[model samples]
Target: MEVSKKKPAAGVPAAKEPAPTLASGKYTFSKSEALRRYLSRKQARSGKRVSKAKRDEQKKKPKFVEKPFNKGTRIVSLKKRPNNYPCKNHSKPRSKVPKKHGATKVRKSLQPGTILILLAGVHRGKRVVLLKALKSGLLLVTGPYKINRVPIRRVHQKFVIATSTRLNIESVKIPDTINDAYFRRIREKRAKKAEGDIFAKKKKTYKVSATRKADQITVDKQLLRAIRPHPDRKILLNYLKSRFGLSTGQYPHTLKF
Candidate 1:
């Protein structure tokens, strides 16, 4: 049997087409329609007008009022106290003229090799091995205070000679005078220089081993000993051995006591 092919009538409406589906499976609105809907909601929110009763109530509210200043009231002024004022209640008490230890008595001038006691300066109460008395009446002591050239006036009168090797002393106060300040600055600078020197020495010592290789010829242990001759002997020896291919079993014969 032959099938007949026929066209639909022009007056009849075609069958409704199925809606297109996106990956999200949601119905999508046209750009213009979506924008129109958004603008409608914005207009609804912004178009609200203030009521006349609310406006009247706002107008009736009180405003901030400024108070008048009184000219007769007194104002107090604050100022800082002077920094040079002596410390309260800690002033050195004046010593009464003793029957035995009379005031203004000329004691024998301190000489070289005399162990003087530092009574008042930064190294106060500390017994220093006096090197020499400078023309300025200052003592040349060893250690950190030596660089400052601290004056003899700072030392207390309670100094005794160092007959034995061991000595014991206490710390002292640093004066705030101009001379003391100058001395302190000099001490600080010298300390920094000393610290730099120590660091430089350490750097030089460390550089010796770093430049050498394990397979290279053994280093002269005498040269290493001259560089550092203290408690770090073992450490330096081990480092030299590792760096210069020295035999592990061989003791470092160049180390001097």
Candidate 2:
């Protein structure tokens, strides 16, 4: 029997292409000691660069848990770490701020002819009458100058003690509450008047400004009607007289323009 050494003819199956090499553009398959060391070093470097990746990922994060906000309630978050006290990791606490002035302050509700007793200053213990709520929430009070000798002026609600007296406004001439600008102008005019005639002069006119007329109007007619006169007028008058050395005049004196 004889064997043929010639290459396999086309009629027979070609030998497998020696298993095509598995190589990327620049690298070939390798398993040398240097290659192993290079891979180990590369992995070690990557691990060092992001050493905290796992620990940080495991660290708890604040979640947007749904919560109901309360007006007077507060909540704080705390973190616990190994070997450190819980308080040590805390952020600086917020400082408490005082309430807004408008919120902290209180204004007394008043109406025309509400009797008030002075609670502070030189007029302490003196009884007066509330004319109206001025533009700045101050009460316009008077002792009717002619009657009780207390002049027309602005007084804070904090400085007066309110009385049960509420006089009828049906005939009371309530002057419109003048603003700061009006008072400023009046002050300037008075100062100028005190100075020489070369200063500014006012064109006096009796016709009232439209704004003044509007302010004079009652804010709520129903409220006004509901304000009944104090039942103990005689008793209150007697008390005022006895306490502050006052006089019960023949008529109720009100502050008017």
Candidate 3:
């Protein structure tokens, strides 16, 4: 038999010599070591580096095999079955985030015209009449400002103590204009002043807007109309005017609001 020798092409390097084999016909170098040297030599001749991804693709990876307890058992190729046809979900995925500020439910004891005792804020311990519950879950209450100094304001239901005493305020019409949005104060864009000018200027007083004053007057008139004809009018007015407080030997649980 005659062996053929191929001539190397111009500008292209010749192939490397085959890896040395032992008498048993096995490579002297490990498969991985031989592959690494082959890639390095090929890269040097070509003057182009083999990318890690490309090198990894070219590398012969060992197949995963489960170890056998018995040496007599034949090596079987075990493959994970692909999920080509996955199980379909009949229900939608549950949302991770909850929606902000859903409408608050009204308490059974808290109703329109029910007098609530303020449990928090500057007006704490003052009695006020519940006009309605806002969409944001805040209760709309007023001091009638005539009976007490508590102005028409929004208070959380949790912060107010509901009384068994109820008034006939169904006749009073709450203006559609007065809602959660009504109480939101909009900041006016002011001209930027120098740091020195800020201190030089007199501290500005926060006066209630004209529209807010008008709204307060309008609501108060409606509330007063309902209160004027009540049979226990004098006592109710005195009760609202009084401040709620705990004295010596007095417990909240023992006393009813």
**TM-score, every prediction:** 0.18, 0.35, 0.60
Q: Residues 69-117, candidate 1, lDDT per residue (tens digit)?
A: 4855443324345779776797788789765643332235454434444
Deviation of model 3 at 203, angstroms:
3.6
Give model 3 RMSD, 1 decimal: 21.1
Order candidates by lDDT, high to low. 3, 2, 1
**Which residue segments of model 2 deviate by more than 4 Å?**
1-109, 180-257
User: Please, what is the whole-model Cα lDDT of each candidate in the order they appear?
Assistant: 0.41, 0.57, 0.87
Candidate 3 clashing pairs? none
Off by over 4 Å in 3: 1-101, 189-198
Total clashes, candidate 1? Answer: 4
Which candidate, 1 or 3, has the higher lDDT?
Answer: 3
lDDT tens per residue, model 2, 1-257: 69977898878987764423555643344558548767777978887544567768766566334444675544444454368655665677677986544522334446676777787877777776676776566777665443444555678887766666666655556544453344443322334346657546776655555664454343223223434355765565554443343356633345321
Model 3 compared with the native: what TM-score?
0.60
Residue 247's lDDT within candidate 2 is 54
Clashes of each: 4, 0, 0
Decide which is better by lDDT, 1 or 2.
2
- Candidate 3 lDDT, tens digit per residue, 137-254? 8899999887798888999988989999889998899889999898887777886777665557776677888888888888889988998899999999899999999999999899
Q: Which prediction has the highest lDDT against the true structure? A: 3
